[model samples]
Each structure stands twice: as C-alpha cells, then as structure tokens.
Target: MKRQVKPIREGNSEPGTVSLFSIAGIKTLLQFLRLGKKSGALLSMAVATAIYTWFYQWEFALGVTVMVLVHELGHVAAARQKGIPVTAPFFIPFLGALIMMKRNPRDAATEAYIAMGGPLVGTIGAFVSFLIGLFTGHSLFYAIAYIGFTLNLINLLPIHPLDGGRIASSVTRWLWVAGAAGGLFAVIFLKSFLFFVLWALFVWDLFSKYIVHRGKAAEYSCWGKIEVPFDQIPGENWMLIPFSEREPLPYRTYSDMDGKQWVDINWEEADVVHPVKMQEQGLIRSVFSTKVERRWQQTPKVVVLRYQIDYEPHEIENYYEVPEKVRWRFGISYGALAIALFVLLDLVQLMMNEQGGFFHSLRK
Candidate 1:
C-alpha cells in the first residue's frame, strides 16, 4: 500500500494532453468563442425566434428564422466579396433581418448587387422549400415556402428602404416619387402598421435626399463661367477660378470681341476640381485680344483708366459621370424586378386559393 506509483509518461498517456473541460482549457475555449462573436446578431435572432415560436410553433418559427438568416447572409456575402465591411445579420421580430454595412457602395452597380443578393438567395431557399413540400406532401414545408416567397417579393416593391427602391434610386432620384406612391398604397390598402412604418421611412428618405441634392447643387453653382473684365485677366494669362468648399484653381482665359465671348476659358487644373473631366473640357471656346483699346482722351490723350467687358455668361451645367458598372446594374435590376413581380403574383394567387389571402394564411 505504501509503494510509490510510477510517473505518467507525457507522450504515451492521454492525461498529458489538455482536457477540454479543465480550467486552462476552458479559459482557452472561452477566448476562442469570444473571438469574432456576433453577439448582437445572435441576440436578435434569439428574440425573433422566441417571438415567432410564441406566435406559431417551434418548427414554423425555426424555418422562418433560417430563411431570414439566409436572406440577410446573402447580402453580407455579396458585400464582403466586394471588399465592403459589413456586420452580421440582425433579425427583427416581425420586420425580418438586415445587415449593417460599414460604408456605402462606391457606385450604383455595387448598391444594386448588394440589394439583389438577399432576394436572390431568399428566392432559392423558398424554391427549395417548395420542392420539399411537393415531394413530401407536407403542409408545413408549403407554409414555410409561402412565407419565404411573399417576404422576399414584398421587399422588391419600389419603396424606400426596400431592395427595389435602392435599385431604382441608382437610376434616377425622380424615381423616389414612385417609391413614395408605392409606400402610400401599402399603407392605404394593407392597413397594416408595418406599411405605416414603411411610409414614414419613405418620407424621411425623401427629405434626406432633398437636403443632399440641395447641397450638391450649391457646390456645383460655385464652379462655372465667370465673366471678369479684360483688365482683371493677369498679364501672364493665369486666372483664378473660385469653387465652393474647395481651393481656387488656375484657369486660362481667351477673349473674342467679334463673337462677344469674354468667358471663353479652360480650366488649367481640371483634375483639381473634376477627376473625370466630364464637364470641364470643351466648356469654353478659344478667344484672344490683339490689342488694348484706349477708352478716354484727356490733355492730349494721356488718360488710360477705363476698360470694359461687354458680355456675361451664365454657369454651364455640371454633368454627372456614369460609372462603368451602371450598365450591368441596369440590366440586372430590370431582370430581377420582372422575376420578383411574377413570383409576387404567383404567391398571391396561391394564397388566395389556399386561405383567401396572404395575411389570412399568416393569421391561420
């Protein structure tokens, strides 16, 4: 009983290895778990799942939660692929899931792609559900598929904060008026508090866009054709052009008395103001003066104090530079919109036949 036990060999026995449940191992495990943990996303999903489970059943709730997660993850994936920093998908009890991006897309195409990815992946998930229902003849699968289809389809409506609205906005700011109308229709016809929220969101978006556009217009007005007297032009032919919120840049002026064009000039440092040079080059034609004219005669023509410019020109309109990606985005957006409409109609008809309407089925 008093004999000493042999020491355990480190390499030959399991006791030498770290135990996952041991104190040190546990601390390491905790650190690993904390790394890249998306606590907010997990919490939101848990709360949403709990709400859905309470309203319906565990299976239905799980299915819906998975679908929304898949949809939002689609956006996250696309953004990441484009080198955009994005957050994990966060779920809302009834509103669905969303991903917070760190910054805006560089162009319309990037925005459209990011918006479309969610619906594209969500639609695939719905189709898979539909197939499962068809094969198994399970009504639960059908219900899940219906929810997926309708939710994604609704997101495609031309309303602000929706995928379709973002896509349309890239084409023209004027299209927001149409989006506002759609929001109004949702509020009036659906009579749902969700639509009311959407309408309010659209109104806020319009106001924000107006403020942004006004600021842009003011900035644009500062850089344009400025008619200065001939006397003001530097002898070295260097003119200082004023720009709003930016440093003045060197400009070259040409005068044409016959054409009555005093504002004929070109920007010497076009890159300083406009990177694309879309609206700056060819903005003014060449004009020159061969001689200076005497304006007054005093005490045998000794006075040389008056100079004048005959004409003033208005500011030339600024041109918007379309990125190369716009064409591709335009094509993809329309195609996606068409598909969304078709899916929406199909879901509506199916829901009507099954439960009188989409909302009615949801209630059931």
Candidate 2:
C-alpha cells in the first residue's frame, strides 16, 4: 500500500502562495529603494509638492515648485559655466530650494556671478508667469508670479548666505552692514519666526567673524599623519618639497577632518622637514648597560617616519577683484531687476483689485 501526502498550505492558502507573495513584496521594495536613490531631486520635489498641496491647491504648489527648480537650474548653469561642480536642487517645503557647491568659488566675483544667476533667471521665470496670467486671465498664475518675484527679491536682501550678500562681496563689504539692518527690519515687518531665526544666526556669524576672531587665523589639524621615508628627509635645515611629491589623498578626507577649514600645504613656504637639533652635554650621569644578543637575519630596509603638519586656511587675497565697470553693471542690473519685480507685483495687485474675476473666484 502506498501513502499519499496532502498539499502544503499556509492558513488555507494554496501551496507556494506565501513564498510568491514575499518574493514579489521584496522585489517591489527593492525597486522603490532604487528609484529613491536615483531620483532624489524628483522625490524631494514630490514630497515638497505633497506638503504644499496639503496647505494650498495642487496647481499652485506645482507651479511654485517648478519656479524654484528653474531658479536653481540658473545657479547650476552659472556654476557649470565657471567649471564649478554643483549638486541638483533640493527642495524644502517652507524654506525653498537650494543647490550645494562641490567646491567653493575662487573669488568674490565668481561667487557673485554664481549667486546672480538665480535671481536673473528666476525673474525671467516670473515674467513668463506674469505674461501667462495676462493671457489666460488666471489668478493662479498671477499668484505664483507674485510669490516668485517676492522670493527672488527677498533673496537679494544682501544678507550672508543670500544671493544679495554674495553679490555685495564683489561690490562692497559695506553691503553686509546694510544687510544686517535690513534683515532686522524684515524680521520685524514680516513677523515670521523663521526669518527672525535666520536673522539671529546671521547676526551671530557676523559677530563671531568680525568681532570675536578679527584678524585671527583659524587653526586646523590633519586627520592622519603623512608618512615620509627616513632616507627622503632633507639634510638642510629647511628645504622646499614639490607638492607633486606628496602622497595623494582623497579631497573629502581632508575636507571632512577640517570642516572646510583646511588649506593645501604651500610647499614653497612650508618647513615640512626639519633637521634634528643637537644639544651640548653639561655633565655625564651614571648609566646602566645590558648585554643583548640576537641571531643575524636579513630584514626589509623600508622605514617610514610619520609627521602631522598644520595648515592655515586659504583666504582670498583680493576679495573684490571685479572691475569697476563690472561692479557698476552688477549694481545696475540688480537694482533694475528689483524695481521691475516691484512694479510687476504692484501691477498684479492692481489687476486683482480692479478685474476681480478670477481672483474673486479663487477667494470663493
């Protein structure tokens, strides 16, 4: 007689159903992870959109997001033109979008150039929206245009970390002082806690740099010691070592160690290797000796001496290297753009008040 076995089942489910379900679930999860990793900008934009949609209409939220993206792309374009590496725009729901630099600009002029790109192109984006509002008679477009113009104008407030502040670096440091006052007024006028917090931080940064650490060089230490062979030590008291002769290390390794305060070693000015100093003996003290014996054997002759060297942070000698003509041009362009945006805002407000068609519908 032959014995038969019953079909395998999971809680009355068919055989292999649970296994197939688990495998499919794992595959879906893996695909989602891969998409998240690859589409960071898209994912962030989606998240920001969702958050904004929670508070406002989806159309307005998406339009605002696109405007922010356009502004960031302007920065990206300018950075790439100057051979600088920059990351894609990352959106924050309330704070707006920003791009991070892989490397800092070489001069204040370069910084201003990169900073100016945003508002310049962002203004064009707003203008386009304004035109669309006029053509379609849509209050939504007008609202987006107004916000875009306001955001770009606010960015030109000459505050540190803001586009205006950076542009002022190439123009004049005096603007920073003006920025502080303006920022305080803005905080008060806007009555926004976030703006107040930003203003406070900016004030603290200014105080720390100008008042607390004025004219003082920042100190930094290396993450790891550099190894030099004993035979390679310079015989002279001081000698210059070619920068190329130094070991190549990852840029991130040093950058992470110094919090972006570390500067490359200036071999010509650096005293990397120093000769040993000898001191004269005044008297001889009692010494003990012990006999040590070892079998003679061949050993590797390679020996490395380790050293840790500190470097002063790199500073731009000429912070304002932009020409007088260029500075004037930047100032004029900045002022003109700001004035135009203000005019547009006024025009939009007038249209909303006088026409009251789409704007009234939106209110309803």
Tell me the tens digit of each residue's lDDT in model 1 across 1-364.
0111232122212355655466557457546668445866876798899999998878789889988987898788888888888888889888998886665555666776788788888888877877785677555766787788877877876676888776665565566687687767867877889879877877765765466444442121112222233443344433333222222333344333222222323323222211111121123322212122232333232211111111222233422234547745665765665586476547545744564453444444
Q: In angstroms, what RMSD does candidate 2 have relative to the true structure? A: 19.0
List where candidate 2 sits over 4 angstroms from the true fold.
Answer: 1-38, 218-313, 355-364
User: What C-alpha lDDT do the candidate models reach, one value each?
Assistant: 0.58, 0.66
Clashing pairs in 2: none
For model 1, the stretches where C-alpha displacement exceeds 4 angstroms are: 1-36, 211-325, 328-332, 335-341, 344-364
Clashes of 2: 0
For this target, which candidate reaches the highest lDDT against the unseen true structure?
A: 2
Question: What would the TM-scores of all predictions be?
Answer: 0.56, 0.66
TM-score of 1: 0.56
